[model samples]
Target: MSASHVVYVLSCADDSLYTGYTTDLERRVAEHNAGEGAKYTRGRTPVAVVHSESHESRSAALSREYEIKQLSRARKLELVGGE
Candidate 1:
């Protein structure tokens, strides 16, 4: 098993962005799609996995998540192909 935390980007139903971290990426994605994920995603179902990266530690994943959150929408779009 991968001893890493996964940072994921979700494209929401409203065409918004959501970033988070999890050890089980597939399960997390499923939760989000089912509207049982993050509070922000509860109302806006995740449409797709826009981006995903793994880190050696949860701290690293969190740091990366913060950085990605700070990025402009345009740059984030560049990071993950825009729809």
Candidate 2:
């Protein structure tokens, strides 16, 4: 069996949002919090998992991550269960 892939949203220290896909949700979020993740998030540490959705494959997870990234802040908040 294979582990699930997930598309996740993180709330940055400045209250902005970052979206990405990963196989290990917990570890990825920890990396962001540790300032070892994406460049945009490194300066805004202490990111927390605001939302996540599991997918069947890496491709599907990436697709969803792209979709979320293209959304407006208002729409993203709606998808993440509101502000």
Candidate 3:
């Protein structure tokens, strides 16, 4: 059995969007809220998991993360239902 790999988008406290890969979505979101996640998200705490996609492997998740990161802010928001 293997853990799930996830590509996720977060809506930050400052209304910024962040994209990242994680195996544990819930825990990662908690870490972001605690100001212990990615450096970019540290100052933008209280992040919410606005979007997420599960992949079979870490590589797939990471690749998707990269792809999402390349999207413009408007596009990213579209992925999260324009929230």
Q: How do all models score by TM-score? A: 0.89, 0.93, 0.92
What digit string (tens of lDDT, one per residue) describes model 2 on residues 1-83?
56499999998899899999999999998888888899999999888888999999999899999999999999999988876
Using lDDT as the measure, what is the rank order of every candidate, best first? Answer: 2, 3, 1
Local accuracy of candidate 3 as per-residue lDDT tens digits, 1-83: 56499899998999988898888999999999898999999998889888999999888888889999888888888889994
Question: Cα RMSD (Å) between model 1 and the true structure?
Answer: 1.6
Clashing pairs in 3: none
Candidate 1 at 17: error in angstroms? 1.1
The per-residue C-alpha lDDT of model 1 at residue 49 equals 89
lDDT accuracy of residue 50 in candidate 3: 89
Give me the runs in candidate 1 sitting further than 4 Å from their true place. Answer: 1-3
Error of 3 at 17 (Å): 0.3
Sort the candidates on TM-score, descending order: 2, 3, 1
- Global local distance difference test of model 2: 0.91
Question: Which model scores highest in TM-score?
Answer: 2
Stretches of model 2 off by over 4 angstroms after superposition: 1-3
